[model samples]
Target: MSTFGDFFKVTTYGESHCRSVGCIVDGVPPGMELTEEDIQPQMTRRRPGQSALTTPRNEMDTVEIQSGTEFGITLGTPIAMVVRNKDQRPKDYGNSTMDMYPRPSHADWTYLEKYGVKASSGGGRSSARETIGRVAASAIAEKYLKLSHGIEIVAWTSSVGGIHMFPPTATHPTPSTNPAFLSLIDTITREKVDEFVPVRCPDQAASDRMAEEIAAFRDKSDSIGGTVTCVIRNVPSGLGEPCFDKIEAMLAHAMLSIPASKGFEIGSGFGGCEVPGSIHNDPFILAPEVPPLETGATRNGIPRPRLTTKTNNSGGIQGGITNGAHIYFKVGFKPPATIGQAQNTATYDGDASGTLEAKGRHDPCVVPRAVPIVEAMAALVVVDALMAQQSRQVSRSMLPPLKTNKPEIKAMVEDGP
Candidate 1:
């Protein structure tokens, strides 16, 4: 099914070349404040033609809310949002030869066999444009998660082509305990953003090399792909369901839905496969203190245990559930398939051809635009998890009420400086 989530169902519709593309959110709680502006920034981030590295197809990608909101607040009805498609160049794909000679590494061949017909222009529903609705819907979900639960999600390119950069390891010590500590964290995150500007690498020299490689590849009329790492911090434990709809499973489902995504791993991911169980396991430790006496919870209550594993070999997930640790994961993308180099192919009528060259604007690498898409999908997954957790049949009295003073969450709502 194109729809996802058990508690908060999101159905995306329309095609790349269609009149418009949009999404329908079925289970957003009533009284949540939402607006078209809240979702536009995300669409702008994923829209093509934003920079030199992406396709030249320019789309305004302005979102329009059709229903489910009254005076900027949700009404507990299905929320529908649409983005009109502009700058479509159907003539660019006039050659019917694609009917027989499918683009290598694309869904053309399989889609034809499965559906008997496909959109001739821009790969139709399979186009990256399909992600517009997803990003828009996810923007609303993100706002809700932040405003209601203080959960924040962010993603960035960890590697391009084959270059990899180490993320910052110094945890922001209690920001409230010292104002200077908070400033330090903010400075580091900003520096990291700047260091990664050329290639999203924290290592300056490595980033420079990566930029050189990207420029060289662009000159060669070829494209490449790389890895995207996402971090979801301040996620409360127990958000994921047991048995079928586990957190990681749902996250994988959402991430794989992105265009050009081929592989997925959480926490340690594939790297952990080489380590033994002893090395991969996360050890639990008791919290120093617990809820206040007025809150009626013991300071050492249940140990308030945390996964203190020195290494995150399991990717912050244990027993198919979140363990209140930062959830980290990586996604792999293959090079963009539309290259300028000529290749052997056939005509639409099945006639053989010697060499065919593609004629259209395309990215040398899709990782940059994909970074926000990854973050958006992750936000959707976590928000849906929170929805599921909140909607559980259990009584609220059995669990501690959510805390609103989470400081790490504030960083998520504010844009990167």
Candidate 2:
């Protein structure tokens, strides 16, 4: 189903070349302040035609709030938002017969097999443009999460094609913003769009190489793909459900739903599989000074030194639940199949076919633009989990206070001054 979430359900509709694409977000709390402006920035980030690296199709992508808000405040009804497709190139798509001949490595063949039909122009529902509604709804979710909890999500293109970035370490520096969308061109002089025009790598030398590679491929009419890494921090524990609704499972479901995403791994993903169990396990450590027992702490005031496997072979997920650690994951994207180069294929009539060359603007690499999309999707998953957790513990009286009686603390105290 296109809809997701247990408590905070969201249903998205529309297509890439349709009149508009939008989403209806249900289960939002009443009285939360929301506006079109809040979502515009994220939409703009995902909008094509922003730079030379992306499709030249320019879209205003302006959001229209159709319902669920009164005077800029949510009324506890479903929130409806739409983004009009201002710059559509229906004519640019050429002939329908050509469309009937599926593009190589795309969902064209599979979609037709399952549905008996598909959008003639563009990939239709499979297009990246379909993500506009998701980004918009996610913007609202992010705002809510920020207001309620201090959680943050970020993603960056860690590698592209043959170039790879060194992992961040304690000794090495960390970027203020994730490197995913940051300008890749590193030079003493300020760069205009052209200067930062290659693959989005900050390292000047590597960026130069990447740019050369992209230019070479573009000239030859080919495409490439890479990887994106996302990090979610400050997420409170106990936000995920056990059994079917586990946090990682929910996140995997959402992330895999993105178009062109081929793989998903959290924490010490595939790499962990190579390590022995003894080397991969995280060892828990007890806190030296637990908060004063009177300060309303759990019996184990010092949380167990979590399943601190020395190395993160399991990717920070244990028993399908979050264990109060930073969650990290990577997604692998396949090369864009809409390359300009010609490929051999059969025509619709099954006649002896010739080569077909793709015509139209497309990214030589899509990993850069995917960074924001990944972050937006991650935010949606985390916020939904947070809301679900909050819903289950509806009674404040059920939780112990932050402070307790002095006598109770003394009674539980161990031998020591």
Among these predicted structures, which one has the highest TM-score?
A: 1
Those runs of model 2 whose alpha carbons end farther than 4 Å from true positions after fitting are 167-208, 286-297, 300-314, 395-417
Deviation from native of the Cα of residue 287 in model 1, angstroms: 3.1
Write one digit per residue (lDDT tens) for candidate 2, span 338-391: 898778987655654656676666777777778778878888888888777666
lDDT score of residue 94 within candidate 2: 65
Best by lDDT: 1
How far off is model 1, as Cα RMSD? 8.6
Task: Score residue 269 of candidate 2 by CA lDDT.
Answer: 66
